[model samples]
Target chain A: MASEIVVDKLVKRFGHATAVDAISFSVDQRETVGLLGPNGAGKTTTMRILAGLSPADGGTVQLAGLDARTQGREVRRLLGVVTQQDGLDVEISVRENLTVYGYLCGLSRQASATRADAVLTFFGLEGRANDEVDALSGGMKRRLAIARAWMTRPRIIILDEPSTGLDPHSRARVWENLAELKAGGVTVLMSTHYMEEAAVLCDRVAIMDRGRILALGPPRALIAEHAGRGAIEIRCDEAQRDAVRAALTAIAVPWREMGAVFSLPDEGADLGPVATLAGVQVHHRPAHLEDVFLRLTGKELVDD
Target chain B: MTEFRLRSVAGVVERHRVATVRTWKVALTWFLIEPAFVLVAMGSGVGQLVVEIPGHGPYSHFVTPGIIIGMVMFHALFDSAWGVFNRIQQGAFETQLTAPVTVTELAAGEALWGGIRGVISTLAIGGLAILLGWFPLSALPVTLLVSFVVGVQFGVVGLCSASASPSMSALTLVFTVMATPLFFFSGSFFPLEVLPDWVEPLAWIAPLTPGVHLARGLAEHSLDLSHALCALYLVAFTLLLFPVAARMLRARLVK
Candidate 1:
């Protein structure tokens, strides 16, 4: 596998604020990697640097081994960006918008027209070719933005929160399109705050927080390795809750306390004390990415 | 490489083309019909009051260049001001930034297209003036081209304003304090000879005043040294402005 994207200690500063701090990562060609981070965790900033939309305050960015600053156009030729905000022109018709973007990406008018039509069909927007973009739904506008990005046949596609604010149905459509891109061997690097999206769409994910990668691995492996097999909650009356926590923690057990409940990892731990009590209940389940996130990064992400 | 460059420009122009063509009615109305209405309304209604100064010719002739200047300024200013301002404020420029187009290419495409649009509008308005017996009728192409090029000058002024301005208030401040006054005092409406000598030097420094001077020569058929200087001033204005406007746009993009 060829390395398509390389960022070395990237940093971006906004006045007194350091948005991204010494972040380094790479995406291999044809790899669908996700950067999962909370809002304001610098995921969008990192993508902006890679897309050459924002300049890095420190370090270097190379796309397919070309310097982003020195040979930006060369690198841009290889990369397609699907921004979080939909940037489609409102007054223009759907088909006309794509054709213009196609022309900007080195296609002739006729070529752009043909490519625009094909893309319209590909995104299931064939019926909207002549309609104004403002007349389309939120989903259609997002699809158009995605289609416009891919009009140039880029070697790598970077999506910054592709499904940030879409409905479930619209999200499914975007996911389907992403699956098609993956099947066709297009390298993808996506940033998303949705744990389920990262777990489902990405081959591997880097869990980011506070401008650093806290954990990096495949979804199942990360969950299993960090959060264990599952969690069991022993919910008890107020008087019994402390006794439950004390019983669980007395054996050096890893546990969490929330009101009248004591949750512990179900990794073959001693549950003998729990069985002796009537209010104690053991519930086992498959671990999830959310659990892994909670265990490794703490619950502060939601707050941030 | 050249092909790619062309494509890059196409990309910027095309992104706006849908809106551009769809708003043809608006552009035509602003550039063509509205200007005609202003010319006809202002020319006929105001021409009756000219009291033609003996050597300066009919009141319409004097107002011809004034209307031409006003039309070009309106076209360019409107195009660059509202359109470019909206794109920047609404974050549409980000789309162009991600495309293969260079910032220079994008700015150039936009400014030139605006100039072209201004040319179209001003020509229609100029035709109305001619039909109303403004000038002798040989000043068509020179008047049109010179006035069209003026679009780039004023458009750059507006684009740079948008790029550097933190908000529309700042943009408005620039027009209020500087741009509007320059237009009024730039010898567009009245003869420079009428101005006091102290204010004369300051008015000469404004951009489009030279545009009026050059067009005046062509309209009157007297290609003298002042006319040549005015023509040269226009070329210089365009050359200096384009790169600076592009730089301002680039600065806005990364930040």
Candidate 2:
């Protein structure tokens, strides 16, 4: 499939701090890609540039085959962007929100009303159609925000932290909605910090930090390449730390430290020497993107 | 060749309409109570102390037009400046800009809504004036037209102010410094000729002065070359400020 969104050598700067350093990536039509990173990791900045809400300091973005810079009006018509803030008019009804966006996209009065109803039903917001946005729970408001974006029938949607601040059930519902969108073949480029969300929802994931893509590929492939088959976690006392480090180095295995716990890639290596250390506990578990992120940055994924 | 989109402008207006309608009890109460209280208290209560004025027959007649124009300017300025500032802070325009709407359209829609609000205020206060026999029923059409012009004028001013204001307190300060002076000095409740010679020039230059003059002339059946000039002044002010307001909002919103 042709690339639906292509970003090349994108750079964004805010005074002395670079928000999005020179980076390049693309999302093909009907494919979902996630930009996974911690806070201030340039994900929102990148999504904003692609949505045409902010200017890029350098480089280019193409959405649905239209240049985001030169053909912004055309590009915007094919794009639906949900920023981190839901940005709903809390004073209005849930249905009115969708209709307003429909009209903004140049739908006729009758068409906008029809589309509003359609999207409300599709997003399971029809039951709350007449309710004021302020009266709804946080999850309903987020769903309405997405439904409003979908009202324009956009070919591609850009969401920044779509499921942030939601309970597990609400997050699952949002995920199911997104999965349906993907099933219907809408291209999606989303930014998220949740490892499980990216792992489950995205066809490919780009791990980013400090304005750079640290790694980009399928989730399983990235795990295999960076974290190996599993992770061996060893918790030891401060006194034995030096000896434990020496024992692991003598065996030549890659490892990362988090407080008293040392996590090493569970390659089938001899670990009897390290296991025999005094006052040390050892265990093993399946590898995940958290381990990959830790292995790549030597920093905890949830730190930032 | 034009970037202006009428549909987008209409969309924004519709949103504002829906918002106003949803809180119609509050709006209706404002429409009936605020203007009626101001007009009756100033027209009857204060008019008794003054009795009459030269060139215009009664104090009631002289002040009615002033009150109508004042109400129009007040509604337009409040809805555009303060309302726009609140919406910007809430990131409302960010959602609209993601669609096929342009910044120019958004500005135009806001100005148009301001005009609508001005018209509503005018009808309320002008209706009270007609019932009280302070204004002629024949002048309603021209009065509404003038109200719309003045509304557009102040709407642009409000947009410019909101775009430049850095914080809510800063916006309040701007309004206190700018709007309060304009309201008091624009010949709204009294003639500029009675003020000190130095203050007269300053009062005449207040942006609301032209709208007051034109509205008063139409309501009193005293239209002249000066009234035409007042209309021209209002039109020129709107034309000059509209693009500046749009550009300022674009700078703040699209960054």
Candidate 3:
């Protein structure tokens, strides 16, 4: 399949500090790729450059085979962007917001209205279509924001933190909407801190930090590579923590400390030695994208 | 590309139209009722004291055109400055930029909206003036055209100021410093000749001076070389400041 989005060595700088430092990635047609990182990791900056909201100091971004820097209008025509902030027209009704945005996307009066209704229905906002945006809940506003993006019928959609700051129920609803879009073969590029959101929604995940992508691959593949099949979590006190660490190091297994617990990458290594240690509680769980992210960034993915 | 640019501008204007329509009650109060109050309190009340001005027949008639054009300036200024500033704070500019709307096109749309609003206020206030027998119905078309052009000029000026203003308080400060002087110094209430000679020449420096000159000439049915020059000045002013305003807003937003 052809690449719908290609970012090559994209660089953006604010004065002397580089926000996006020579990062490169691509998303194939109909693929969903998530940029997973902590705050100040350049994900939002990179996405803004792609969406034509900001200029890049270096590198090229191509969307749907058009150069983003030179052919910005064409690139924008092909891509819909949802910034981290809810940019919906709060004074208008949900349906009016979508309709007005459709007009902005160059839809005709009739076509804009038609597409607005369809998008509202698709995003499950048809019920409150006439209600003013300020009257809607935060989750409803978010859904409306995403629905506005679909008004253009864009081939590729770039969303910055698509489901951030939502209740679990609302987040799940947003995920369901996005999943439905992904199922329909739309290419999606998103930045998110939620490991589960990335693992569940993205076809491939890029772990980013300090303006660089440390690892990029399918979520499961990244977990298997960075964190073996599963990891052994040993909860121990101060003395036992050192002993557990020394035991894992003695066996040549890599380990990381998480407060009172020591996480040892279980490469089928002899866990019997660590488990036999006194005054320590041990538990083993399957590897996950969080482990991969923590191992790559060397820091916990705390909420921003 | 030009066609698409036009479409983008139309979209933005349409959004503004819908928003304005939604709050038309407030718009009516600003455009119609406020002008009437100003005319009653300032025009008729003040006109009663002044037996006659030299050239103009009545004090009310002398200030009628000034008031109409002043409304245009006021609408253009407030809409482009405060309205665009509010939209920027609300993130609507970012939202529009994400679409196919270019920065220049967005600026054009905003400036054009200011002009349209100016025309609306012109019609509102001018219509009331006609109903009260203070303005001529025959001059409505020319007054509307002049108001639209002046609107666009003030719009660009407002946009530039808005781009530089860092906060709402700062913007209000700028407005108080800038617009208040123009409001009084521009011959809106009295002729510039009435000021001290040194101050009279300085009053001509304000942009609204030419607007008042042209509007007074038009309203009094006394067209002359100065009115024609004022028209040219307004157009030139709009053309010169528009790109500057667009560039400033682009710098502020695209950063």
Candidate 4:
């Protein structure tokens, strides 16, 4: 894979507040990379700067070999963005919206109409093309937004939580579409908080917290590297709780205490301990990416 | 394949036109119906109270030129303020920021389009006045051109004001405080011939005062040529505001 994006030392400030404290990252061609972080973690700000929706105070961003500052038009031309919020026109029909976006990207009248029809069909919106965008359902709208982004035939596509605020069915469909995009050789970069979604979909993931990348690698590799053996959830009464903690610690297991639920991790290293804890009400489970993510970036909530 | 840079001004204008044209009933209501109401109400109620100028003819003669000037201000200010504010607040501005369109292009296109819409309404009112048998309606080409320029001048001012202000309410407040006063004090409704000298200085700065002067000049040759140079004053004011407004819009956006 080749690097499709290069962002180095990006900074942005609003008044006195540093929105994106100097940060850097890149995504490769034909790779589906995930940017995972909590809400207000500066993920959207970073993407916005990359998309040229806002200027970075200091940084260099090259997309498809075009420097964002010098060749912003070419940078914009090569990349497509599906913003966190749907930027659709409620007053226009679905087809018209697609055509307008296509036209804005320099598509000719005939080409725009044809592409709009194709995108509408691709997104399962062929029959609804003439209907107002406001009349579309949540899933339909999300699908439309994604489709609109596709009208440009971009080499690199950035999705900002493409499935945010969607119901289960809508989320599943969106994920499936994203998976299809990845399969078709389109480089996909996204920021999301859905732990399971990242684990299942991302070719590689970068776990971000407070504007910094804490951990990066394949999900299972991260789990195997940091989580030790797979995680084991145990429920013990007060009388035997100390014994379990002591036993786990004596064996050099890493654990997190959250109220009464204890999470002990061994991260795909050995299975002997699972057998030992089996009769002790310990349910040994395979360590998930969520486990790796939570381990690297502690689960404590930031100041709310 | 699509290009990386979007031609956003052309794109947005094309998009706006498509959307606006689709909603013809609503647009007509905006472009026609409401303006008709104002013209009828104002023309009928106040049209009876005035006498003709010594050489210009009927009272309605003065009213057409003045109403045209007033409509120019009303349409220009209203369109730019509400239009730009809505786009900025609604995230449409973000699209333009990402596109190939520069701030200058977007602002110019918006001001131009707003002026066009203003001109349309002004003409509608002008036609209504003629049908009601007001002015003798002599010259065509020159009057229309001058009126068009007047609309553009005011439209630029409105665009600059809207882009510089933080909120739509502030735009409205500024209009009420500065614009409305200028409209009345400029001697549009009543001639300034008999007014006290103290109020003379204030009228000098009123844009519509220059606007009215030019309009009257175009309509009737009796209003004096040197006085119509006031319109040139408006032209200079518009020229100065263009770059200032573009810079403000650039800063306000792309944040």
Candidate 5:
């Protein structure tokens, strides 16, 4: 499949601080790519640059085969961008929000109305069509935002943290809507902090930190390569933590600590010796993207 | 298939129109009521105290044109400054940018919308003036044209301020520092000749001065070289400020 989006050596700087630094990636047509990162990891910056909302300091972005820098109008016509901020016109009705945006995107009145109704129905917002956006629930507002994005029937949809603040149920509903879009073969590029969201929705995940992509591949492949087969998590008291570490080290097993929990790969590790350590509770689970993400981006707290 | 072409300015105008429709009663009330108060207080009350000048007619007649022009200035300033500021801060412009609209187009559209508001306010005041027999029916078109130019000029100026303003309070500071002085010094309430020598020069340099002169000349049917020169000045100022506003807003928004 031809690539729907291609970003090469993308760089963005805010005064003296670099926001996005020489990041490169691509998404095939209809492929959902998740930009997985901590806060201030440049995910939103990269999405903004791709959407032509902000200019890249260095590097090029090609959207649907058009140069984003030079052909921004044409590029924008093919893209539906949902920023991290809720960009809904609050005074307008949910239906009017979509319809007006449709008009802005060059849809004829009839066509815009039709598309608005379709997307409203698709997002399960048909019942609230006349309701003001400010009156809607947070999840409904998010769905409306996404529905507005889809109003243009864009070839590529760029969502910046689409479910950042929603409750789990709302997030699940949003995910279902996105899953339906993916089923319809719409190309999606979303930035997310939820490891499970990326795991469930993304065909490929790019782990980014400190303005650069540290790793990129399918979620399962990344997990398998970075996290090994499984992990044994041990929570232990502060005093016994040293003893448990020494015991694990003596057993020659690779391990890492995050707060009270210590994680070790489950490959031929002798758990009997480590389990006997004082004040330690051990639980085993299959390796996943969270492990891979921590392995790539590290467990350091990102300030913003 | 339905044709899809980029109509950035039209889109902005449409958005404004939708918003205005919902709030037009309040807008129309202010547009009509405020000017009535200003005209009654300054035109009738102030006119009673001052004798007529040699060239200009009654003080009421002389100040009516300035009041009309001042209406444009005030509307344009508030529309572009507070209006643009709210849209930018609320992420409305960001949403618009997601479409095929460029920042330049957005600025132009907003300026044009401000001009539309100015035209609406001018029509309201002009219609009242014609009914009261203070303004001739013949001068309506020219006065409106001048009002529109003034609108676009100050609209662009206001948008430029809005682009640089850091917060709502910063916008308030702009109104207080920049607009208030222009309002008082633009000869809307009194002639510039009454001011001190140094202050008269500052009044001449104020953006609203040329607009006042042109609007007054058109309303009074007193066409002259100075009136033509004032028109030229307003046109030049508008042309210069349009691109400046667009570039400044683009820099603020697209960065």
Candidate 6:
């Protein structure tokens, strides 16, 4: 499939600090790609450049085969961007917000109205069309933001942390809407901190750290490559650490320590000896994207 | 390969129109009542105390044009500075930027909207002047045209300031140190000739002075060479500042 988006060695700098280093990636048509990273990992900067909201300091971006640097207006026309910040016009009605954005996207007044209605219904916000956006709940506002982006019927949608602050139910609703978009074969590029969200929604996940992509692949593929099928976790205090390490070494299993817990690959390795060790608890489960992320980016908390 | 469209500006102007309509009560207070109060207090009350000026006829007539120009200046300044700043902070411009709208289009639309508003407010004060028979009816169109030019000029200036302002309080400093001082010293109330020798150069450099000169000349139907030069200076200044304003706003917004 032809790539709908291509970013080559994208770089962004804020004064002396480089926000996005020489990072490159692509999204195929009808494919969903996730930029998975912690805060200040340059995910938002990359998305902003792809969405034509910011300029790249070095490298090039192509959207639907058009150069983003020189053809920003055209790139924007083909993209529907939902930024991390809610961009809804609080002074306007929910429907009006979408309609006005549609008009800005070059739709006629009549077409804008129709598109607004369709998006409102799509986001399950038809009943609140006439209500002021400021009066809507946070979740509803997010839905409105997405619906407004959808109003343009863009071929590619870029969402920056689409479900960052939503509750479980609202996040589920957002996922359902995104799922619908996926079912309709819309190209999606999203940045997320939620490992589950990326695992569920992304066809390919690009794990990012600092200002570069550390790994990129399918969720299952990354887990298998970086974390194996499953892991045996041994939790023990400092006093019991030596006993646990000796037990794992005697069993000939490779183990890595993260804080108070030690993780070993679950390659049919006998954990009976480690489990039998006193003052240590064992947990065995399938490896997940979170584990891969932790392995790639370390367990230290990324300061916002 | 992508073709840029020109229709995006109408969308931005429409959005501003809708927002203005939604807040018509506040808009009316600023566009109409505030100017009326200034006209009454300065043109009428202050007019009563001052005797007849040398070149200008009556106090009320001499200051009427100044008050009208001040209205346009204030409206354009506030709309482009505080209004643009608030919209930027609220991500309003970002939302539009995400669409097919270019930064130049956004800046032009804002400047045009400010001019339209200045014209509307000018009409309000012009109507009052006509009702009271304070100025000649023949110069109404010219006065309004001058008011629009002043609007665009100051609108661009305001956007330039807004682009550099880091916070709302920083904008307060702009209003205090820049706008307030310009408002008082720009020959809006009395002639610049009455000021001290050192202040004459400052008044000459004030952005509002040429606008005041053109407005007063057109209002009184006394378009002399100096007033004509002032009008030319305003036209040249607007043409120069508009692109600068657009570039500055683009830098601040596109990041």
- DockQ, each predicted model: 0.56, 0.73, 0.71, 0.42, 0.64, 0.69
Candidate 4 to truth, TM: 0.85
lDDT of 1 at A244: 78
| lDDT of candidate 4 over B1-255, digit per residue (tens) | 223223455675677677777887887776667756765655566666655556556666666677666777777776577667776776666654454556776777666665676667656666666676653466434556656766667667777777778876788875888678867777666677657888776776677788777677666765565565785687787778877877777787777
Tens-digit per-residue lDDT, A83-155, candidate 3: 9988887767789998898988888989999999999999998999999888998898889999999898889
Candidate 5 positional error at A187, Å: 0.5
Predicted candidate 1 versus true structure: per-residue lDDT over B61-133, tens digit per residue: 7667767776677667665766777777655678777877788888877777667766776677777777777
DockQ score of the complex predicted as candidate 6: 0.69
Give a tens-digit lDDT track for model 6, residues B65-113: 8878888888888889998888888887899899888888888888877
Answer with 2 or 4, whichever has the higher TM-score: 2
The C-alpha lDDT values of all candidates are 0.78, 0.87, 0.87, 0.73, 0.85, 0.86
Task: State the lDDT of candidate 2 residue by residue for B184-241, as single tens digits.
Answer: 7898778899999988988877888998898888878988998888888889989998
Candidate 6 Cα misplacement greater than 4 A, ranges:
A233-280, A300-304, B1-6
Which of 2 and 4 is the better model by lDDT? 2
- Superposed by TM-score, candidate 4 places the C-alpha of residue B216 at a distance from the truth, in angstroms, of 2.5
> How much is the lDDT of residue A170 in candidate 4?
91
lDDT of 2 by residue, A1-304 (tens): 8999999999999888999999999999999999998898899999999988889999999887788987888998898889889988766788988887787788988999998999999999899999988898888888888898898878999999989999999999999999999899999999999999999899999999899999999999999998777899999999999989999999987777788888887778898999999999899988988888877776666655
Q: Alpha-carbon error at A142 in model 2, in Å? A: 0.8
* Per-prediction CA RMSD (Å): 3.9, 2.8, 2.9, 4.7, 3.3, 3.3
Off by over 4 Å in 3: A234-280, B1-4
The lDDT, on a scale of 0 to 1, for candidate 6 is 0.86
Tens-digit lDDT track for model 5 on A4-114?
A: 999999999999999999999999999999999889899999999999989899999999999998888889898888988878887567888887888878888789999
Stretches of model 1 off by over 4 angstroms after superposition? A232-284, B1-7, B14-18
Question: Top model by lDDT, which number?
Answer: 2
| TM-score of each model, in listed order | 0.89, 0.93, 0.93, 0.85, 0.92, 0.91
Instruction: Answer with 2 or 5, whichever has the higher lDDT.
Output: 2
Give the least accurate 10-residue stretch of model 3 chain A, judged by summed lDDT: A295-304
| Stretches of candidate 4 exceeding 4 Å from the true structure | A232-282, A300-304, B1-8, B53-56, B135-140, B143-147, B164-168, B222-228
Q: How does residue A264 of candidate 2 score in lDDT? A: 81
Q: Candidate 4 overall Cα lDDT vs. reference?
A: 0.73
Candidate 2 chain A, which ten residues in sequence have the lowest lDDT sum? A295-304
